[model samples]
Target: MLSRLTQRLTRGSGELREAAAAAGELGPRAVSLVPALRAALGGPDGGTTTPDLDADTAVAEALWRIGQDPGPVVAALDSVFVRAAQNPWGRWAGVRAARAAALLGPAGRPLTPRLHPLLGDPEQVPAAALALVAVADPASLDRTALAEAVLDAARREADPMGALRALEALGAGALSPAHRRSLAALADGDARVVRSGVEDRIIRGDETFRNRARALL
Candidate 1:
């Protein structure tokens, strides 16, 4: 199975991403597949970036999980971050790359410069802050500032799961008195947060977000 997946990574087949993900799940046990995963990120032509951002992301993540090599994996992730910017749906991919960088733990320290700038990006801040916590000593980071950024991100209409995850990373102690008040208001279904939307799914998701917000208090 690993050999088959490795073969898939060497080509530009549609299944390349799934193959990389499956290889990543095997973790260090799939170390032998690292070269193939790296090859996949370079595209079938070797030097060109893969057009499939998702596949490139998967391969990058797999390389880190299986090989623990920071250089190539970080390069691959950088490519994802750069390429993803061209598409409307790119933020999601950026979020994933942030999380993948977090998986590197302190070894991902090199990515701090990139992550720091992302703190201003509403869509990426939550995940980026979380990644910072993962790669840096929490003592070195300004938790108060990070918490504030995440709180702001949570207010966005797009579901704030990233914010929730980021806040959890920051720990309950990171919350200031004002932050608590804001969360309390949100939990109580503040008019600002409880919007009248037509999609039941979004409404239900918001309700769930509220419940989770309340749990933080």
Candidate 2:
């Protein structure tokens, strides 16, 4: 039964890959794959013949395509998160969660109100944190409340990704020169991936950082 399920689930790997490649060639229209791709990632009865490599690659390609349309990306993310929550241990749940969060980072819409609760779940926490940090609007995030959340998460969990994500979200706010320097120093801190993302924002002068930098100046 499991084998049948896996086989059915994975049968579309070739189509997904072809769709992804074609979408890349076709540009934003690639969003048409959102439905099929989401199902491929989340469907239970589908056979698992598709390798993890194929699924991950297809998702990555779909994300690249979605970057051209935030609305579709946001909708896709909503679906991905819903599926991930339903099957926490599903083969690609974490991957879907992470990609969904990454895609939503820039949209900054209210469609993601469930983030805090999702972050509380151990299985979904990392992806949830990434989403929160990515989508947070510093101008709107309650700093005091967010700080408390980060500090609380730090004290409660051994995984540093959660606290680091919270810190990144907080850092999106205007920082004093001193604080900016402190965060800049973290560009070389222990978490290479998080630090790399922060540094990229710093280098690109992301809108949030630009606002903060403007205030500091």
Candidate 3:
């Protein structure tokens, strides 16, 4: 079954077509497409070298695979980041780092300082930092520096999703009253979908977070 699925997914039409069609018809078996999706994204023509439809599809596909298997997803993302760093569009490296960070499983953390260069820019730093916090061993993080970075990212990022991700990584025990207030404010943003799953985990008592947010225009 896996071999047949793999062959079907890697066929000429692209994994997205197979993934979507399988998702619509095969139900749970569609999950098998995840690895193929990542494979295609990180493939020679995976789109990491250029920001085109194929690249966008690769990122989206990788994101889906992360939801399915975060460990492999993080590894794949790490590869993408390395490739992106080597590419001509190296400036987008932070963005790729941030995306990789977001995909990391709770136990995954980079021991190498590859992400440090991007951390200097608040706009670029928070997403990558938040992803680090999400996956890093708390003992591994430099608490003082990470706290400062999170605050800076929260203050500088206009995107609610970015702020929410950092806040979620800060977690309930780590957050101050001010952070809670900021998260509450984000409940109404156009980017609420990005915060939904993570925020729902945070505001465990607030069943209304999901319902009220859903009513957004």
Candidate 4:
């Protein structure tokens, strides 16, 4: 199944997106597809309006889905970030790179310091927060710093969906006391409404944090 999907990833069109999605759906079984997925994410710095851009999103997301530990999958993303950091167009790819690092969880912890700067970057805050909360082990990271950043991003965001995406990525089962308190503090008029909408979706069991944001929008 992964082999078929990987072959499709080379086709330079719609197949690229479908192949990347298939790799993600296959999960750990798709780990072997890492090299091909990496190739797809290694861009020539295409514009957002291009099909290559869509493939990059799918491939960036798929790499993390394939595996989380510091292996081919994480290396693939690390390479993308390495290049993304050097190229002017890389900022556009920065969000997905941050997300891939976050999804790697404990293995991704080493990346926290590198990601810290993006926490204050207006364009990258939500993605950076999503990554930070994933590694708030309380031992390695300054939990207070992670919590404060999450709160800061959520409170400063103008869009309800953007805030919700960052929060939901923190996951229901994993939320710490500080996280709960911070989220609860978002209570008020309009903000409360957005929270309720998110809660309602939660009650109904929306699939993923990213899915919830898309459905809400």
- TM-score per candidate: 0.85, 0.47, 0.53, 0.60
- Judging by TM-score against the true structure, name the best candidate: 1
Please write out the lDDT profile of model 2 over residues 14-67, one tens digit for every residue. Answer: 445555545445445445555445555533333233343334444544655555
Candidate order by lDDT, decreasing, is: 1, 4, 3, 2
Model 4: colliding residue pairs: none
Q: Is candidate 1 or candidate 4 better by lDDT?
A: 1
Task: Mark the regions of model 1 whose C-alpha exceeds 4 Å error after superposition.
Answer: 43-51, 85-89, 137-139, 190-198
- Better-scoring candidate (TM-score), 1 or 2: 1
**lDDT (0 to 1) per candidate:** 0.79, 0.47, 0.51, 0.61
lDDT of 1 by residue, 30-147 (tens): 9888877876775322322334877787888898878888989888777777666656667777778888989999988877776886776788998899899999776789999998
Instruction: State candidate 2's TM-score.
Output: 0.47
Residue-by-residue lDDT tens digits, candidate 4, 1-217? 8667867878365688788988888888888888887767645454343345446657767876766546555555555555555655666567766876777777776667667776665557777777777754545555455545655655654333445666666555445677666565554223432333567675343234334544433
Instruction: Evaluate residue 74 in candidate 1 and report its C-alpha lDDT on the 0 to 100 scale.
Output: 81
Which scores greater on TM-score, model 1 or model 4?
1
Q: Lowest lDDT 10-mer window, candidate 2?
A: 187-196
State each candidate's clash count: 0, 11, 0, 0
